[model samples]
Target: MSDIFEYAPAPESRDVVDIRPSYGLFVNGEWIDSLGDERHKTLNPATEEALAEFSYATPADVDRAVDAARKAYDSVWGRMPGRERAKYLFRIARIVQERARELAVLESLDNGKPIRESRDVDLPLVAAHFFYYAGWADKLRHAGLGEDPRPLGVAAQIIPWNFPLLMLAWKIAPALACGNTVVLKPAETTPLTALAFAEICRQADLPPGVVNIVTGAGETGQALAGHEGVDKVAFTGSTEVGRLIARSVAGTRKKLTLELGGKAANIVFDDAALDQAVEGIVNGIFFNQGHVCCAGSRLLVQESVEDELLAALKRRLATLRLGDPLDKNTDIGAVNSAAQLDRIRELSDAGEAEGAQRWSPPCALPDKGFWFPPTLFTGVAQSHRIAREEIFGPVLSVLTFRTPAEAVEKANNTPYGLSAGVWTEKGSRILWMADRLRAGVVWANTFNKFDPTSPFGGYKESGYGREGGRHGLEAYLDV
Candidate 1:
């Protein structure tokens, strides 16, 4: 809640999306009622308003979707040449670009992320994943995977709610490009954009059953991931759920890839530009309200400049805006849901109980929906729960290190190794730290930077397999 930069309430219009009272499951390329009676309403976490009710997919519904995907794989997608499949992926990407504003607005309303992020970050990245994969569809042979890499029959893809459409594109684009049919399940809280994407699949005249979306909670995802018919399973969410999915697919022919949780360390040395490092620190843990799986939640500053860096970081965080997600001026928005908010609060409170000093800027929060002020914890130790765990919110835990050796040791101490950041002016120092760091992705002067062409995933408990670049095609293809 930063009041340093005050602006008018420039809220983005939500009329771009036509929300239906109820949404049926998207299976076999069409909307259909779920066989089960379970129903849940998707909410606008910013206002706690009901956006729409969505049917939860039963085991039977999962079977129907798996059957459709299998049918499409055998009859259409699998047999089609990569070049022919590329055309469909291209169409989807183009349509997403054309409807970018609508999707951005809908994304903000449903996911409670700032409209600026949904529009500039999420929507563009969503389209980029498709566009990037569309170009790769006809070039898989040159991808160095294999001469004739074949699609892995049916793919069961379950994406997280934080970046719904983007994660959908991350899973679906590469799967389709590699000649596989997919049965996707968007996260329960943010299903509107994925449902809209099902319409986009229709608009592209994609063959029936080629791309299917079944919306529900964990149970529906469980049914789909555990189904016997799917040849590939891809998921992006919590580490605990990733473990369950990994176990479910074990001892089976199903190929699996998981992008799970992280407690990334953003290291800043004394030689780093203080002003630049401050901004990077803010972007590292505060981006997406720190809902990112690979967020740099642990700040490992050089002991020499810890005081200077902390002061600058605190000042920058105080200028960040927090309020209505639809407001074009807002920086931080609502937490995704009450459950996630509770988790953030529980962990943050534990940080205090464990003796870490907590600080927040003076700002009034809206009373309507889920909200947490951007928080900072100093005097943090590696053993502290806040430093060890993934808070997955706008909370930063600061810890200092003495040397390069100590920095690497501290950064790699966590069970998660999704990403890490190094902020030093020396190129040699950056290269030195990057080589020693255990993280899958290492940023030198930046934080939270993503590109469609770069391969990304993590080591150990953070999950396995890459999700972008030529390496991404490997997950959906059989070598």
Candidate 2:
């Protein structure tokens, strides 16, 4: 046998999933044809093959979805007791766990993420989000938001392509737990999981019109977010789009919460464990092919251990296998789409043009799919586009700092402040850095860690409001 670490193809079976040839809007707890004839193909990013064709919801469709949600809110879901809602949430969680493998396979096929990640990380977290919120369903009075927290009526939720199912759970579970009806729109590129989730809702025997899913591109999302019938609007995507949503809902009575972009900093001190820090740094940026909104794309290292860390990190990156997303052994997967890959290339090219040294290991990419190597940029200045902007790809920009103050200063320098990571053996220094960092979520000695019980959002341009825990309930509730 070859070396244990040597990559052998162990592709997951796709036979478990049955992708429908065509899909439609899930409105009033039923799949219905779109009002408009506009349709788009949902592609398998790993193979560039069209998996299925799905509808693009027109303005009328959005109105229908919003109206359905409104009716559900006023008639059934909104008036339902928290205990009854919890039963549906719990049932959904159980069904998701039972269908976990199917969802994982579909997610990898559709979203172009490694099977290891979708199976282990995304699906588990998706179930956990539902389970977590289920526990909070009947306990709103003690949630500290208010003595009697009421549902916010119809909520308009739009999720990104990166973590489709998990983001859906994040938006839906809390809204349902708080007894609010929702009309959700998944990203144009990755709507399969969301549509599957609508099936889950049906399976769970959720009330009609309680949850509506309309799949489409930007214009459909704009219609949903700007719908006057929506009592609250929540979105997870680009900051530019977040700003537009903020502007669109500015004067409306709608309560809006956004979880947008991030250019997070992962700071490693000289005193940190070199091996541990190296793993953390790699995971921070390269996990999910660095498509995460809060990915630690910026590595701020202490000047003393920069060389040592760089050498170790480079060696680790060389071992990473990038190929079929369905391959269980693959570490890096394809970029989500041609357009996203193009954006990554444009920004990476800009990094090289602006004087940063870019390096990639010997990654033999697949011929057909959208692929980008696990890239690293040393000598990356703070002003460089790679350092300042969210590449949202498998790219890490390395910069150096001298002390805790300097690390905090450099880490907080970006317009995005969603999260920051610190790796240091010294407890006091980690505490100090966490206190000083301007990001919403700061991880000490760990990166990209999330729990449904903990509230997550960001500061400034990273967008406002929290999405998990009891705080997440506040967004969907009227105190």
Candidate 3:
């Protein structure tokens, strides 16, 4: 589905089209400079360069975006027939596929995720999200939730920097398909793809103010969540911030959904295929530089084969290529930003300081980029800082379990119950562990499996609400 002429210059070209961090608020289908006093630089995590400058939306601007979304929700989007709405989503999906290459490249260059992942995981899931939700536009009556689950009016959504477009799609597709207009704020580290999506909305001839995107930091996000005009608030990020958002929306009429952080446990039983277990462990926490809400950051290995598995994991990690996200061969890219790199460093240091045996694969990381060697800390006790806290980087905390009961207890020990992996050949053990693990997603053999038709979310401190599948529509509905 790709061609030689699909992109600018050849694949070897370094300097691609520059989309400076846009300094404006997308409101009423137009991009206008924010009436704010401050601006921020969105950095290229790979090169540690300020790739673009962005304007911080003041509380007033957030109100304006909410007003615009409210106006569109009541006047246009809300009134549009389900079939007509479906057409717009279909158009957007087509445009995303047509320009998939550019989006894939832009996402990689901004978020510092491998281009292969952006192309494969992020982009396809984004497209499929739209495609899956689009069909439901006219089929809401048969959704099984109610006679008709109507829109929740205007939604204020805050997405993380890791999977910019994919996260955006997860929020917006369902909101729009269910007839809700949105005011979205992407993370300061990676706002490019979301801004690009605004252009895609325009290309799709989507109704004005139906999907407004505002780019900024925490203050902007706080303004969006606390604003009186928003009918719903949904966020995907840290549990700390999620708690603040929850507090802000406490007494309000607004519906809320939070897809916060995770410290998932990937448990490998003695019966697990050794090679496959190694691959699952590597992919679990190392992918996307481990900037995942449901990342398997904790490894719970059966004591019998713990040494063998750890050896293989370390060796496999060493072979991973770390470099430019744009490079096809770069298996692991830099962290999303310098701050994130610092956090990873700080956490890694804490692991060592706390007396855990920390090990980083002896891979040469690029000096210019915000890179951290894929790190693993063994002998990690549940009480250790590295084992308990969410490092949110390419860092894995390894712990051992002597029995099945101990494994389940350790796996479910964290406040996060977002996801957990069980690698085993035995069907009985797979189902047994799946039943015991208090995770929203139980990856029996695979590590990170996602689809638009599959439900995803977290429990406990990891936050609440489902993001995908037929059930995802609940968050946007009046029911």
Candidate 4:
């Protein structure tokens, strides 16, 4: 009775969102049909209901988009004053803020993340990203690149489904602010927000072909990335795909930036605040259902306090509510797709088969849509598959270390260097670990916090090139 009383269905009203039956591709500032007859259905991952059908971009469609972008770059946007360009971005940001509720509700409906997260985390950040980059539009001359850095002619950007709007903002905002026209391909599963963003672009009265969205799966991305007219290629997706893009553009004049996967380690020392550390651990791997590229999937704890930390973590996990994504109180939501859910299961099963002990809190999952429980595997070795691979799900692998040196060694053992977290009472030790950790973003006593002004990316296999701040502008500029 108490458990039932703890959470009641407080679902957000879906009436706020008005989804269309079919959405055409947004190219050259117009809603145009794809050249291909093939159409993909976008479904609600939480309900497995069809949200909308989107046409897949063919090679010809990609060519058309590139041509439009090139025309815009050569004729209008490329020659526009920086201050004028700034106004367009500012308008888009204001429109995003104005339509925040609709976008948030639609995002949750389409992406299967909790409404609270879509509304509170993704939507706000999307708007903030545009606002942040808008200010940089006119200030590019002072960005320290050189005197009067010029825009790369056109950027072909490919983003994944986990963060549709936010990733779009990250890629498109900086490129547009730098005066580059864009041909962007949104992931097939989450193209609605990108198309809606296209509408926002129209509302801003952005120059035609300045920002075009070509929707499709991997093939469309390949067509866009390999397109000869593109001057730059920026991608945020799997490392496998990123490597493919890198190879596709080899010897070409295209400037490339790839933000790929991560297997971050969250280290908690014995002297740290135990309760707060537990919360950070929860937020690290479970936030966004652990779909984050920089998710702290690896937990490295000082052996002396491992027992206490695990106990507290399990207690906290038990209280997490999992249900309808639109439910305001739901903490965990559906996995983004059935394919992603399968990947999470396969990796987790490998953990158990490889001698790690798997545990999940007792919770009933919805029967209708894709779902995965918040899971943890203890007694994991460095050699375990779960420890090394990017599961990209709500799963964590715990490893214990006796010394700070051992902790650092275990943390840096992975090929990915995207993000890491360190928790300790001693400030000096935090600095030491942070300095040694090879990841791009290091959070001390915190996890999964983001800001538009901060640079975010990875080192090594996690991929090169930062995505935010002034460093992001370098990718789109010709210095």
Candidate 5:
């Protein structure tokens, strides 16, 4: 932590926008006070400094947001022509691009990811999502749904902290494409980008109350999830929370889609392209400091390749640079927040206590902020907690497979079925493994590749529905 603050201060930006330190709930197309006076400060996980303060939306505030959404659905959003809705989405996409720098900086500061990723990956994907869905706004009649397909009305959406602005686009773009009003809640740890999205909406001339942002912890999420006025609920978070949402909307008329936690298996066979496999494993498990829900937390290798892979992986992990997220060369950033850091620490400790051979690359972690070295554990069993549970961090648990059949069995052994990766030269094996793997998304010879046209989600306890592509509209469309 001390090391984090000890670094020289970042130079004053030449950019025009001054990042704000406080934000309010955006409801009815306006920034309003929380129904209660309570507030929570969002922090820079890199520096442990408060980057901004955001309203803690209460139950009453949720009611207000939902009512505003309902009003918008009836008076403007629902009645608006799909082409007009398409134009709004286009406008939002343009605004997002025009203000991409501001968003990327704020996202990096609050979420502690590299500025490059926020700009290149998160912001671009966000804008692309709107652009892709925008085209669909007027084409729903041809979208394979019945000719008279209608919007789901008011949608209540909750996004996780990992990819704040982009996830917001994933939820809002499709809902708007289908003509549904939205009440969105950004994760407590990273609310600045969502508030920034509200400002973008303001610039786009999006109708009052079409898109609303409420900031709070899990309780605020519960209010939105269970709100009677909400016609649909979309959530992205932990599997445990997703299950609660599943049960909450069980007997109700409200529709539900949940994108939850994953403990993905990245399998490297003896025949894999070694360099590609090494890079894939690194990116699969270490990107975003390993906070991704679809993070490949478990490393599955053919027994014959285990020793060679570990040697290369250890050498590669050792070379990664870690520190301030804004640094041009920083490959790993701080964990999202204190609580998330604790979770990672506890799991890593469990790895050591449970007798796995723990090894973290030699790197310096700042004392002023949450930081953990890129880690790996060898000699792991499927029954081990390190291998079975979703640590949601940079830690990877290693297990060796003697055969392809055993690999498939071990990969599907977990409660989660979010994603998996297979590295092999055999064409038949790729399709066969893809068939046997019980995951929503499978990467063959690649990992973590995402596109707006490709739907991404999980199976089993990883929750339901899809978040991108033509299939993504299912969550917001009326059957």
Candidate 6:
């Protein structure tokens, strides 16, 4: 493929980011060593290169961070005028915009996502989230929740590695905007950007302890989520983990919100614009190496057009460039971690064992790094694990339906219902489908589209509570 075009590698220069050799927990607006000596190395999935080492947050360290947040809330952040808090948030948003390129490069380096997506999609949304929530800071009384919504103090937020910086923004911006302080733990695999965000808080002159960053894995998140001082817990990851956190916080007064896993369905009707629908299908599943919680991992096409759509979709998959997260032209980058890649392979193999036909384009992958070729499984039954479970990779399972009612039934059959997409030219049909889908978000002709002002979450085992929009404010509020 390279010989055909003689394409040169256009790797984004990592010189844009200055990652520290090691990092400590950010507590009370200062960097301090962990109480324990245990440390873990954060690696780049693209090359398995050690990017940085970060100390794990011990239970004591989590307590210190939570205490700091609580102290800040009681002494300063809670008493701070909404207008003043808005100014701080606005400054952070402006700084994020100014350093967009740096954050994008760092995000790609740390998380193994294409620089194009990090630069164009994640960074922009992160800044916009802050800007959007900044406006809401001073206007909560008019947000329809109550006459005067009050902040839930000392929120503890645990985010996933898939969209490290963007998830940070999603968790932090609204929590801060509602006049609450936060103790946030970035996923152990992708903590660089969050540490960099601590720098942003310092640049904005945010009050000490107003925002703290703890870098660690599941144990650290467990400690933070179960801490008694924390008033609220917001988590984004797997539903299994969400259940554990829910149990840990049970019988407590702690308010909780979860944005967990999904196995979204992208439906293509015979009347849809075939070419655009194919594009949506590709973007929905292959974007971010299919690491999205709301990724359209399943394709439910009207039976009349299944063959045509599958042929067109395979052709589109052939054109996807997979390699080098720093490359400007790469479409699919490395999977986030070795564990995630193995999970994808296991589920894809199960798809084959369960009698589904699997296919991939004749594209060569890099000898090094964690990568999975864009794949699609046809003749997938609802009983197939590939169709029922979240693969979280660049894989799609295709199924067919005979009627709108059948499509609705098939799409809603999953245990997860975070998001769904329907492609059709008929406006009435689109509305009808949207009204019947049991998901938080429905895209009529588009797929994987997001906005800072729009609420996004899930139903059923996909977890509860919404993030973004006016509804997002309620999660951190005590009306």
Candidate 1 regions exceeding 4 Å error are: 1-5
Which window of ten consecutive residues has the lowest lDDT sum in model 4? 1-10
What global local distance difference test value does model 2 have?
Answer: 0.94
Q: Write the per-residue lDDT of candidate 5 for residues 1-479, one digit (tens) a residue.
A: 45443444453242635677678889999989887988988888998987777889999999999999999999999999999999999999999898888788888888988776777788999999999999999998887877778999999999999999888999999999999999999999988888888888898999998998999999999999999999999999998888898899999999999999899999889999988999999999899899898888999999998999999999999888888887756788889988888998998898888899999888888879899889999989888888888888889999999999999999999999999999999989999999999999999999988999999998998988888998898778986
Could you give candidate 2's per-residue lDDT for residues 60-140 as a string of tens digits?
A: 999999899988888888888888999999999999999999999999999999999999999999999999999999999
- Tens digit per residue, CA lDDT, model 6, 67-147: 889899999999989999999999999999999999999999889999999999999999999999999999999999999
Give the number of colliding residue pairs in candidate 3: 1
- CA lDDT of each candidate? 0.93, 0.94, 0.88, 0.95, 0.90, 0.94
lDDT of 1 by residue, 1-479 (tens): 97655587998887888989999988888899999999999999999999999999899999999999989889989999888998999899999999999999999999999999999999889889999999999998899998888888999999999999999999999999999999999999999999999999999999999999898889999999999999999999999999999999999999999999999999999999989988898988888899999898999999999988888887888788999999999999999999999999999999999999999987689999999999999999889999998889999999999999999999999999899999999999999999999999999999988999999999999999999998999999889
What does candidate 1 score on TM? Answer: 0.98
RMSD, every candidate, angstroms: 1.7, 1.0, 4.1, 1.0, 3.3, 1.3
Model 2 clashing residue pairs (backbone): none
Question: Relative to the unseen true structure, what is the C-alpha lDDT of residue 245 in candidate 3, on a scale of 0 to 100?
Answer: 94
**What is the Cα-based TM-score of model 6?**
0.99
Per-model TM against the reference: 0.98, 0.99, 0.96, 0.99, 0.96, 0.99
How should the candidates be ordered by lDDT, best one leading? 4, 6, 2, 1, 5, 3
lDDT of 5: 0.90
In candidate 2 the C-alpha lDDT for residue 131 amounts to 95
Off by over 4 Å in 3: 1-22
